[model samples]
Target: MTKTRRAARTAHTSARTHRVLLAAQLGNSVGDGAFYVTSALYFSRVVGLSAAQIGAGLAVAWGIGSIAGVPLGHLADRRGPRRSAVLLALATSVAVASFLLIRSFVPFLLAAAVYATAQSGLAAARQALLAGLVEPGARVGTLARLQATLNAGLAVGAALGGLALSSGTRTAYFAVFALDALGFLVCALLLRGLPALPGTPAVPGEGPRLVVLRDRPYAVLTLLNALLLLRLPLLSLVLPLWIVGRTAAPGWTASALFVLNTGAVMLFQVRAARSVTGLPEATRVVGRSGLLMLASCAVFALTAAGLGPWPTVAFLVLGAVLQVVAEMWHSAGSWQIGLALAPADRIGQYQGFYGTGVPVARTLGPLLVTTLLIGWGVAGWLVLGGIFLAAGLATGPAVRWAERARSRAAAPVAGEPVKAY
Candidate 1:
């Protein structure tokens, strides 16, 4: 084939793969939205679980899942990422279905653990699949597109879940759960349609079994990323509480802020990500995002000045706009830097280990953000701003350190010459 024809064929294939992945992401994200909305209610009202039980059980479940991710991702590396993703997606469907049969706390915990583990593994496997299919230059753009699709899917799913929430009937809750399970089934089928990637083989005496565990530089980056991810719980927990207890804004402003955040992400995330093409740019973007987040927190603090509802609403909206932009920048930068830093053969395990930061932030962020924003109030906001600024500033040094360490690791010992590709 001519070079032009070959390029055209490759572009066509990439587009097809991108479409399949987007469809699968939409399916799974819809299920995630429904579960996020309805799961707590189902546990308390439908399954006879106490609030304390639900909280503790879920924490333990997710903690287990976080630890399980590394090994499960290694399974993807040892087996094939596509096959592992398909299997894990099906397992998630089964675990979601098991929730329908649970009548007590123990069963709920078991089912939740299974679901969390499967979800974690599925994420790793899917990322590995993406890495294998997409070219290095195009991965971040594709990821941004997927992120936008995820936001759109979540909005649709949240709306469907809201209807179930409004009905407040057992059948409605069950329908939501059923829809969630079916969504995973659909995700698995969509993933199965994509081209398969074969397992990567290990070279003899290369390094430790799980190199990511011992990679100190990568660990530092992960920790820093986790700190940035504190924004996740800030949106879900702190902002709502701040609106209700600390600010003069109406309760509905909280919902409006959420819509604004998600909608902006859907519309502009890809554009935000377009400038981040490499590690240096990624670090720069993240650092700037930190400054933005600090400004956003400062804006949020102004709402408590008793400036009346209109001004308070204005401040809240402005804060949310800044916060969402910072979120998009941070997300875009992290995705690029994380993938850029990983070795091709171990992308699955590396991505899996990196992703542990999400659960870590989710677990610890609530306590940290609530303490700073809710308990401490204005001073707390300043402190939180400082924390984001510090983390963002630190990311550049961390990326450089990781790059140096990776280069050292790849360097040959005495008498060993490097081989050209």
Candidate 2:
């Protein structure tokens, strides 16, 4: 193809792909708003669960899907990512719809669990799909746009859902779930346009499920990813508790979170994408992203000292900016690392393996963060941030070691025994 025509095609694909992202993200934003807050609120206010019970339930509910990611990723690898996505999407919609029938706290949390799994499962498939669709050069930008879409869409969703929720959290919860369902449906429908799934080429006799693990560097990256993300669970769960316990926000306004996620994407993610793409390798990119994330955690934790709403909003906005900047670097870098490490034929499985981090963090970090976070307040977030800082700093050296090892392993030694033995 001519360069001009090729460029045109690339632009077209990006645009179409962005539409799919926008639609899916919008659905998630609305649904997430309802799911995280509405469902929990319903559990506490309506279902009569004590705070401890509610926390346990949510932790349990979120963790159910956390451990399931790798297997689901394996399933996505075998079943075809597109098919898995559609199945997950349809199931997600149904799962969300079932929220309408919640009778008690346990049942509601179960529905929440289904909702959580469906969302993450579909997300893993969707991301794997996108990694296949866009060219490597454009992937970071595409990821940024996708993140932006989620931020913007979720902003809208939170607004509408919050308003609807003020009247009754339960009724709005169902509506939010239904909307989330619609996003999954759009995602499922869009998969038809993608002609193939992204993966590493398969080797004979080796199942595709093991594709991501074949490379030691990739495995190390996954471990690093898990360690690096140790703070997200704390940020999501413990931060909220501190905010309410410490601050006197009028309505448990997590608007700061919304600002942190959405607004950050709007401004800095693209700039971050640009910087990451210019980096030498995915590993370096991830490390830098981690450092940026650590900074965000520090900035975010400052809110515990009690900023006026506007000042808090500023910190929140600053935190959001850093978050998406890191997100841009991390998402694109991680995608590239997984793709480079994975066999061309088994991208789905490799991606699934990469995705296993989510549920892992969701499951384990809560107990750790909660135990420590209760006494620390802002200091806890700072400590969490410091942990992220150390992880970030460790990444460059670890990845260098991984690369050097790969090179040495691939090198043929002059005196090494050959098959002649």
Off by over 4 Å in 1: 411-421
Least accurate stretch of 10 residues (summed lDDT) in model 2? 412-421
Report the Cα lDDT for candidate 1: 0.90
Candidate 2 lDDT by residue in tens digits, 1-421? 9999999988887787777666666655665655554655655665667788777766776677755655666666666677778788887877876766666777877877887677667766776676667676777677776666666766776676677668785566566666766766665666655565533323344433343455566666677777666655644676567557765444345545645655766676666666555336666878777788879878877876676766776676677677766766776676566555444445655666677666667767777677656677667767776766676666666666655665555432444421110
- Assess each prediction's global lDDT (C-alpha) against the native: 0.90, 0.65
For model 1, residues 239-346, the per-residue Cα lDDT tens digits are 889999987889999899999999999999999999998998999999999999999999999999999999999999999999999999999999988889887877
- Residue 246's lDDT in candidate 1: 83
TM-score of each: 0.96, 0.78
Worst 10 residues of 1 by lDDT: 412-421
Best-performing candidate as measured by TM-score: 1
